[model samples]
Target: MTTSTLILPGSPEWLRYFSASKVAALPIKLDERGEYTRGVSRWESPFSLFHRMAGHLEPEDPKDEFTVGHAAELMLAALYRELHPGWRLSPGEVQYVRTDLGVPAMATLDRRASRGSSRRVVEFKTARDANEFGVDGTDEIPADYFIQQTWQMGVTGYTRHPAHLMLGMSFFARRLFEVAFDAEVFAFLLEAARKFNAMLAEGIEPELDDTKPTYETIRELHPDIDGTAVYIEAADAQALLDSEADLDAAKSFAMGRKSWALKQMGNAQYLYVRDPGGDHKKDVKVADRRKNSHGSVSFYVNKKADLAAITGGIS
Candidate 1:
């Protein structure tokens, strides 16, 4: 198969290519026309990739307000141009299809830019707050975004790329992080994609992950219950019961610890952990309690805690 790079993103021709954004229908049915026949695309985040290969339906997009992601998509190119001097930026999406792998794969890069002889694949992202980017005043790219960008680099044959992360709806904070392509990790991702394609061809479903998305997908898969009961292996049934008990115990344990912490907090709005003889200025803030407009109190831990010092690297 020859690589195709001419198809525009979201075009009818592009729809024929496999995309993680497209919802997979349930009952193990695949669209005969497009998705089932095409190769995987870099548009897949790890979560969506797993769901796609597992034959799980993608969740419906929320209909409420315009999302941060939507804003980021619309503004990424313009922002990139404004931030980087002497770089020539392209406006449209750059698509790539690689046919050399065991399973052919494709990707759609958000924008491409060049400075002299240097070229880069650029991706854009948005976060609710700075804490999501990092707690210790550093930008940490999320794993899924890393994988997506790395996949894009692999597909486009770019050695390095930069991901621009925007914080908040107002675009209050912006940070650019560049990533280098990793041959070993990209090889692993390719192998995984190949196996996923195999599973799809063999009509096998991937094992479910313990995630809300998976739970929601399962719920959507069987919306109406038939009056039939299915048999389960005794060990599987026992495991389910054990999991339920474990969840309850974990909840109770967490609640008890929280109650004790709250009691220790007393009338203080913030809780701290300090050295035996340390000054207030040197104290480590642990958690804080705040009252909302509804007259209800909420407690949350400090995101900047040095977990390695606290847990001795156990976690």
Candidate 2:
């Protein structure tokens, strides 16, 4: 079966049911909020989400693009089945309900039961044939897809989690990856969805995202406006200055540390810091120092989190 559109061409019942296709669309009313915005789609931008939540008019995407994308998603689903044997993937049956946040929501899978009876959801994504693989391993999904898959899990009651497959059509290669369910993220999404719906119910407008589209939208909203000046609180001006100063200081501090590290390994392409052990060999920290093709020097540091540590501060 083919995927359904959230804003299907139908009667009022259509508004109550949301499909994955409309995740990016701006929300129109409280009744339609969950169907449009609840799922974790890359379309969930701060600006777009706010507009959707506040029932503001969103910039329209080209009809051609929308149709092409939908077609691509369907084709990818077929390709997935052909590529992976024993996977019972099918278009999801959409169900509309009042979510815990008290807003209408739905989760429709592009293909379900990706890997056996696990009931795992599979999200198919198609990228430009020219785009390079994001991670070193072909099994890793990009950040956006991870969020999308997790969101799918959140709404589908698939606490087992979701798998994502990205297809680069130019090469006809597919990358399969899985994301663990995050309770915190799911809870946050529900709360945020509720808050946005509440804003719509209360007739409150959300702040616009600082983006070109929003700028254009603002211009259109105030088109042919007579010139006028608005007053701001002195505290706002002071806060801006303070923030700039703090950023400048952080930049200088980071630059100094980078330079110092570079100088310490002047002739070497890598630096190894040895932490000597009392009764064993030293534990070494390796950092890469290399020159790019453009003659620009680059440094690599281990930025991964230390799970053993109590705090997020660098160890």
Candidate 3:
């Protein structure tokens, strides 16, 4: 379909219900007929499909930077045309490809490349820093992009995947990684999607990650009730108590170290520690950086920046 035919999500209001991306994220376990499918986006977590099945799905916010990524892609496409004269980058539709489990999957190419019948998938990305794309020239695509681009290729039946990333917020630094589609990874994602979907259909909630956001999401879903109590395994209860005790002990030890450091500093606001074996080496500095109104002491490690000098490489 042409870009003109495509109705951007949240544009006309009614398109939200039938958004291809949204349909692809439905609980896989419930799709017995295997109709709904979607290509994974770059920013989405690998377990996003499973998350959808677990009833934790949230609408993609239009304000998200990924939403701006499309505009960036358009600009990049124009620049790429100037750099590579013969290549054509345009949108192409790939109808749903059936996975081994009979599920229909689809991929919306960011931009399809065609030069004399040779087609390639061009993935455009904007990263916060170069590190997100990994050390330059290593050809290492980050795991999230790997999962996303590979799925796009699998759906499009393309073997060549050319990913171009604009590194950093400045958008000046650039990195291009030529990633090959991996059959093993494609098979794994397909199977994983099916398995997670099945689990969700069976009324099983996905295991929560140890992150504050996940905790907050759960809390929002099920807030405190009026004198409600839930039962847990005795071992689980004991584990929580043990963790609490360990945390308290760790906190006490840390506080003790701070107290000792403060005593050693006395009138000075900083503490310097030297290596016992050598006097020539630089000392480690613990600086009293800032203070709050509550009279809390904040310590900061002052280290010299010598990455290039130390490694004989550019910083």
The candidate with the higher lDDT, 2 or 3, is 2
Question: Would you list the rank order by lDDT, best first?
Answer: 1, 2, 3
What would the per-residue lDDT of candidate 1 be over residues 1-315, giving only the tens digit for each residue?
223457644444443344223212111222454333222232333344445445455434664443546556667567667778878876766677767766656676666778888778776666543443553223366555656666777667777544333333344456667666788867766666665666566766655544455566667667898899999999999999999999999999989988998999988898877644556655667788888779989877777776455445644
Candidate 2 achieves a global lDDT of 0.55
Cα RMSD for candidates in order: 7.7, 8.6, 9.7
lDDT of candidates 1 onward, in order: 0.59, 0.55, 0.55
The CA lDDT at 118 in model 3 is: 77
Worst window of 10 by summed lDDT in candidate 3: 11-20
- Model 2, span 1-315: residue lDDT tens: 223554332334433433333333333222333443223243554444444434445445568765676777776777767766777776643432434536566666666764655666666666642122345234455444555555567777777644555454545665555567888866655556566556656766555443454566565456565788888899998997998999899999988988898889888886654433332234333466766779998787644423233322445
RMSD of 1: 7.7
Q: In model 3, what lDDT does residue 72 have?
A: 74
* Candidate 3 Cα outliers beyond 4 Å, as residue runs: 1-51, 54-60, 91-101, 135-138, 160-171, 231-238, 241-315
TM-score of each: 0.68, 0.54, 0.58
Which model, 2 or 3, shows the larger TM-score? 3
- Candidate achieving the largest TM-score: 1
Relative to the true structure, candidate 1 reaches a TM of: 0.68
**Per-residue lDDT tens digits of candidate 3, residues 200-268?**
567665544444444555655566588978899999999999989998999999888878877777767
Task: Look at candidate 3 and tell me the lDDT of residue 197.
Answer: 51
The local lDDT score (0 to 100) that residue 140 gets in candidate 3 is: 78
Clashing pairs in 1: none
